[model samples]
Target chain A: MTALGHVPGPVGAAPPAPEASRRGLSGYLLMLPGTLWLAFFFIVPTVTLVASSLYDPSGTFAEGYQMTWHWQNYTDAWSEYASTFLRSFLYAGATTVACVLLGFPLAYAIAFKAGRWRSLMLVAVIAPFFTSFLVRTLSWKLLLSDNGFIVGLAQALPFVGEDFRLLATPAAVITGLTYNFLPFMVLPLYASLEKVDPRLIEAAGDLYASPFTALRKVTIPLAMPGLVAGTLLTFIPAAGDFINAELLGNPRTRMIGNDINDLFKSSVIPTAAALSVTLMAAIIVMVLFYVRKAGTEELV
Target chain B: MTAVASRGVRGWLGNHAVLIFGLLVLLYMFTPIFVVVLMSFNDPVGRLGYDFAGFTLYNWKNICEPYQLCESVGNSIKIALLATGLATVLGSLMAYAMVRHYFRGRGTANLMIFLPMASPEIVLGSSLLALFVNANLAGQLGFWTVFVSHVMFCLSFIVITVKARLSGLDPRLEQAAADLYANEWQTFGRVTLPLMMPGIVSAALLSFSLSFDDFIITNLNSGQMITFPMFVWGSAQKGIPMQINVVGTIMFLLALGMVLGGLLLRRIRERPTA
Candidate 1:
């Protein structure tokens, strides 16, 4: 929080001279546009969100003119959104687990076995991201079609009877989340694993340590920071995202995103605001929990 | 000797186990996207998919047939470009100021700028909606509202990218330029500009992509303006048209091509330079 006096103070090696004053003025001028944009949009809007939530139920301004403060807005929305939040949490959590279970191995391979192709593999992980998320998701819809080739394949499975429906299901939403966020998990894990010293593992072996013990003690602990960061990165977006849930999930399995969305569309501003605040708070709490459990500095 | 050899075998299995698991993750990550790319070719006519329909360009043709796709695409391109440009310039200046100059409420400013990034897109859309309604601004919804919102969203990304680059840059470069008779403008133009170009370009590109792909904010803000995503949303409600799959496939392929091209260029350049 550089809310304190943040100024360029004796930054350059140049002997403290007449130029210092000029440089500071120019710098301040340079910063003005961004400062204006932030204050006008970010700060003002945040203030608006809080004030809007407090507006009485009759409307904040003239009756129905604006959101009137009603503390109950939060409580009312909570019951509606509680299951939604739980569903979102479950989807997000499942995605995180899926990424770790799926991503760690690929990361390990790239870091160790696929040495020369590591860059190419890394690029592949990031490649899908370059394209439109909407497009990629739409493709999932196509592939998961009842008569689509993927389903056709599923039907071909032994003893599997009836049409296979992949799209419009909770599993589809989870799959989409995992598809989108796997890269977040893999990249960080790769970064950490790549730096792991092989000699240390050898040293452990020389001390008669079992292979399981070596990995459990050395690799897991050392990679804990990346794992934590990756989990946070995946979990936050998965929980907050409305895209996957919208595209892949049916109405029966609405997540918190759907709840917020309904509120927004219906012009239920205060309740929507409360839900949003809760969502943001949840993320902050998760981050803090991880930090406390693993220590802030070590957990990335 | 036997013990050592057994230890070697155990290490191999341990490493291989991780590798197998990693491959599984990569496969899962890829499968859905891969499926999308593959299905983009299938001609969808409601309950029909990939029947050896013998690949048709009809979907791409359909883009301009019944909808204002060209208009939406053009609008998307224009709005994204303008938003990217605006966000880049303002964000870079702010980054320079925060990183290079003294400013009061710097922490407050940083938090303020980053706030939009943390809040959900819907909140921003709603807040802007309220702001405009209260202000009695013309056009409750349209391209302008969308553009402004895009700019607001892109600003955070640009600021983050530029600030990071600014933080890492050596202040000495600017000082030296100034000492040698360069004015503030000249120093920034010649010295600071070149170093920040990579970051600035990346930030711009990222914002452009974001603006182009945006759905939630656009859906909320647009009154009648139909962007590519709006078109997709409407079509999706009726079950996605094959045109979407075709368009999506093309976009994904294009992205892949650019990435491969970039990699090839890097390889060739590095070979010569090294």
Candidate 2:
């Protein structure tokens, strides 16, 4: 996690001295190429996406779309694909919660209990990232297959029936999402928890607090920044992800990403653009609300 | 005496409980990779490589059995290399500027760098596609378009990684170098650059993996070009070939070897100095 270790540090830290006085045009010169690359590719393209979303729905790619200021595109897209949007959010929300439940303990152990094996454990957490993404997702598809061990084991449970299956269900898709993004959640949580002094926990214990109470009152509050960051990182991408649904889920479980990709493929640009913009806007609003509630504005 | 012994046992269990749970979670994380490695040697009877019927080394022997798999892999390697090089250089410069020098609009610049990272891949891909279409380059979308988009996304990650490495440096080293009558270029080249090399290398590695594994953005922009992920995606809709798992296994092994090798080298190097 060394590469990703310092990401959540204070973003607006002051510039170092010794070069502050000599910085005339050299700073701008150094910043020019990269900043211009981002400006042209990232900033301009976002504006294009927004503009394209409002194009008239009747126009074709061959005939060129007209800027009809069609505010109706939003309503039309929402009316048609609202369920997909909701499903995306639902899946993403579920994935985030599952990640927190699973990731917190793993992160906690690595932070405080792993001792000298901490670096090795951290490497293990991120080792999955080296493999190709699609290949790993395909492995999940195999693991959750109807005749696979997982499903067979589930059937052996008294509560589950003999015909029980895990594949092509919301559970499977959520499982895939949780598994794929677990590292994202763990890393940030570990980053923040690693900074917690043992003395603080001991202090809480000496003050007549139980171990659990110390964790609740002291450790968790200190880990809020990481929690906020981890959740956002997990939720935003999971909400926009379609790979799990496409592979591990049935047609009924398609997320907003599936539709966006389909619409784009079918040459329905404005609608796809509308959906993309809507997803971005929805994520932004939720993230803003979340960060505000969590009181970590500097994370952004 | 019995009561005290039982309490000691209970305390030991309590202390190890979280560690055991953490190891289980790590096991869960590696389950898919285990499946992948197992399936790499699988000899499937049907077109779909779902169930492992028998053991065979056929997939490893002929990894290029699937048409266009190797080609797509070559393209991915080429793109990843080029994208990593460009992003690393450009991003290191930007990081150097942001950390070492005072500049106006620093906050705005930081925001600009952060936005691309925070945005979803779908949004970034679609936005890039939208820009291409607006520029009348829709029909011309190919390797270059995908390359540009890869660089665009990889740039922010490189900057962040390098910036983290840059800002953590002990500035007094450079001050010490200057006191030895070293000029700016000499001090930077000899001292600063050497220290920053680890960060830059890690940043390059991060960008390479990001660019290589990128499917969402590349899929949107690549009109007719098929990268490795795109190849797997296409085959996934049909029946995936067993050779794909071989590729997966190789990637995992290569990356693991490199990282562990680096760690070993670092340990060995630090011993003598320490």
Candidate 3:
């Protein structure tokens, strides 16, 4: 509501109100329902549920049951799942790298090389999104099974050891995340790259700068915003995702997502909620940092 | 011009490298999907490696078998359509209100609408599951809970796409219509609606595909009901069934066909006006 008061009232649709109080009245009225829905569904549920994570099996909030905050639950979660966070980070980091490597060239080609076909390429990049991530990822389980094509290829690799099962490995987790988030990376990158003027590249060539040098000094820095956005999009989902781990990885490679989903369905709500809260906090911190760096105006 | 001065074979190769590299990238992007679709038709008597499967539709016929697996596919399509329609209407009104109508607390409202999208599905699915149980609504949680949950996610997508279009529009065009003695309703109907139709269609298509593909939230909410994702998941745990591959292949191709069709139709519509 307070944020709404800052908006320069609705400019076009309805007739303008008195100049003095327009922003306050129109802003507050229009923003009320959306804010209320968030309060009801998001803020309330998250806060209360995270609070309830302190409850022990006796349903008391504290050892003494005096409504004390038992911060030990947070400590306990770390002791129990110390490796899970590292695994989540490792998996997400690998996925981010893979998507960048796989997606950047496609984006570069689309932005610079393709003339009439840019929109069509974008449509193709986004088309796979029509299939659910679950369906698409699960389909990989069949493709990357012990008896699958990749399995044979792995065995054929000269120095590899015997009985390499690609299905239930960390490699599988990375492969799945990379496949799922490729479009997210490409879309934002294209948005940035498409804005780059073609004349600049020609000017660099005319100035006798090598193609490689021009890309390194010019194109990369210009597309930093999209790269940042794409990295966040890939990393955030990869960290939170339980699907890839559950469908593809061995127990050793299961990330925080698998941890949360595993605990939630098994009636271990408190600890699951605690992990979720911690994960949510990490995401919030990252988002705040990116917003500050990118500036509020850059992002919607 | 050093490469230009090398005007024979090497220079030609350098120029073509981008196109070649691009073709390779396109092939890479297209590979996993290609393998899945081709392998879905693997004949028992054909080559051991299904990098090439004999032209066959055996997998498609597997869906006709009298099993719960087939039922799940039907259930998934029905849920996706219902959820998409409901989300689209709610979201469009919200978009219209945000773009066209001035009201209070709009910033907070906007934040609330988009928050569901950024909030991870794990949190959302569990929260909805807990709420359903605590509220004693599991009996009614079958389709209704799933539908509502899908709308919560889909609505933000709809609003974003439509709002993008609305912002593109010149505000004075609508104002000019009003100045010519057209009422607000008539102005919207005759002017705003026709102009924003492309975005509206895109939003609907996006919403439908999203709802169709959702698995996590649907799984948490659907008690005895099974969507295609759950069916594939449960079957994956047992061992990846041949038929599930069939389902996946069909879904992928069907999605590709529909999206390409929609783009083509939009292109046709644009030409007449252009």
Candidate 4:
């Protein structure tokens, strides 16, 4: 991801160069505190989680659990929560597609068509997110309530029954997920799209290609890095998010996150740990496969 | 004449199509925010469902009327500030090492920094809870545990942000300071730190927001403690207080004010030079 690289400075200017000489002892020393923090708080926790997954189911956290190498925990958690896992991916995947459809146009517009309003548009994209997350989702609950204006409108549509409602539906959950993560999709897409040379599109237009053809042939390929980055950013968090599902979905629509949260809350530590590890592994494998399939090895 | 007029209209629409579409998307994003703002002023006729009743300023004036709402908000602010301070310091150093110094296992360090951001929040929270419980620190899951988790997550973001800023910086400026007979400490304090201030400040702001808005991670680790999100989640199950919307509105306004103030300050500073 470009998060690791230097974001190029103002257009047409060279980015700053890194120091060419190798740094010695001081470099590792400088990294010591942060690396230790990550090791203890981040890496160690992940290791502990994997270990906890193998703990015997009979033990509790209060009484102390034992590491029994309980492989069945994985199998049991997987088989029972398979639907939840599938639903998480499905919702996340749909949210990613929706974000791209909605965000690509917005990013493209800001990059090319916004003119003097570019910064204003960018601020607008981020401003809504600065408010409380739970508060915003709660507002959605209000907006989609059975007697709310949106549902009333939906009821008026053809083939929609009078009993229809938006709240506690998969549609509401997906909408919440999409709304919350749209900025993630937009920012990277804007970063890449803004860097695209305008002349290439103009050249395509001059060569008898229509605007659509120019966009498809010239622009889409150039924005591949951003598309991949935005999709992953949107999808990964969307999959892991339980707040929307909990706030907006009914019991039947529970994702893996909800299951994990409930299990952890109810003191089902081993199962929760196993499920958490499985979800993480699944995401990592999917990401690696995606990066491979997209042939964008520059992503790290 | 009619055909030419139609063609002209088509051309105009073509030119502005994406722009129009984008505005719509932005509108969609802000609709819920509008609801939140509107609901803050709402006078609920009923105890529960979130219909916008008559407008009133009662909720705004009595923001802390709800039980533990203000307390939870105070806790969140305290935790966010502490987490931001710690994460920014550690992260800035790590970013400096990654960008300015070529070291062994540099690639591994970079991977470590990126992995937390890549992992989902549920996994992060559960894994951290697992760690705490395994270490026999389950009983100690409160502000400190939440603080630890916040810093862990915020570090990756801060490092990524500061690394980008540092990588975009020209090393020659510091070299020039050295050539002018300045000591290393003097150069760092006067030249490098001043130049890096914007990045550090923005990274701090980002970390604060992330820490403040976090729910799932905090909820899992925060045993018997209530942050603002936890408060909201609890209230959601019961009847929600209009005061929650008041808090949300105030937060939005505060953040907006900070952003605008920063922009204004930058413009004022640039004016004399320009």
Docking quality class, candidate 2: medium
Candidate 1 residue-wise lDDT, A14-119, digit = tens: 3332222334467677877867776776567666666666656555323344544577878877886788888889998999999888877777677666755777
- lDDT of the candidates, in the order given: 0.72, 0.90, 0.72, 0.89
lDDT of 4 by residue, A1-300 (tens): 121122335665765567735467878898999999999989999999999999999998679898899999999999999999999999999999999999999999888888757777988898986899999999999888888899999899999998898899999999999999999999989988988877777879899999799989999989888888899899999999999999999998899999999999988999999999999999999787767755432343
* Residue-level lDDT for A264 in candidate 1: 62
Question: Predicted candidate 4: what Cα RMSD to the true structure?
Answer: 3.5
* DockQ each: 0.41, 0.64, 0.28, 0.74
What does the lDDT read for residue A177 in candidate 2? Answer: 97
- Residue by residue across B86-156, what tens digits does model 1's lDDT show? 99999888777767666566666765665576555666766766555455552467999888889888998
Per-residue C-alpha lDDT of model 2 across residues B157-273, encoded as one tens digit per residue: 898888878777877788889999999999989998999999999899989999999999999999999999999999999899999999999999999888888888888899998
**Collision count of model 2:** 0
Q: How many backbone clashes does candidate 3 have?
A: 13
Error of 3 at B258 (Å): 2.7
Q: What is the TM-score of chain B alone in each candidate?
A: 0.85, 0.97, 0.85, 0.96
**Cα miss at A107, model 4 (Å)?**
0.9
- Report the lDDT tens digits of candidate 2 across residue range A1-300: 132222233544544543443478999999999999999999999999999999998988778899998989999999999999999999999999999999999999998888768779988998999899999999999999998999999899999999899999999999999999999999989988987766677789899999899999999999988998899989999999999999999999999999998888788999999999999999888877876765432463
Q: What does candidate 4's lDDT look like per residue over B1-274, in tens digits?
A: 9999999999889778989999999999999989989999999987454788798998888888888999999999999999999999999988888877778987678778888988999999999999999888899999999999999999999988887777778888888999999998898899988888889998999899999999999999999999999999999999899999989999999988888788779878989997
Clashes of each: 16, 0, 13, 0
Error of 2 at B125 (Å): 0.5
Each candidate's iRMS in angstroms? Answer: 5.0, 2.2, 4.8, 1.7
Instruction: Kindly list the per-residue Cα lDDT of model 3 for residues B3-62, writing each as its tens digit.
Output: 766776776677656655665766655666665666577654532332333666776676
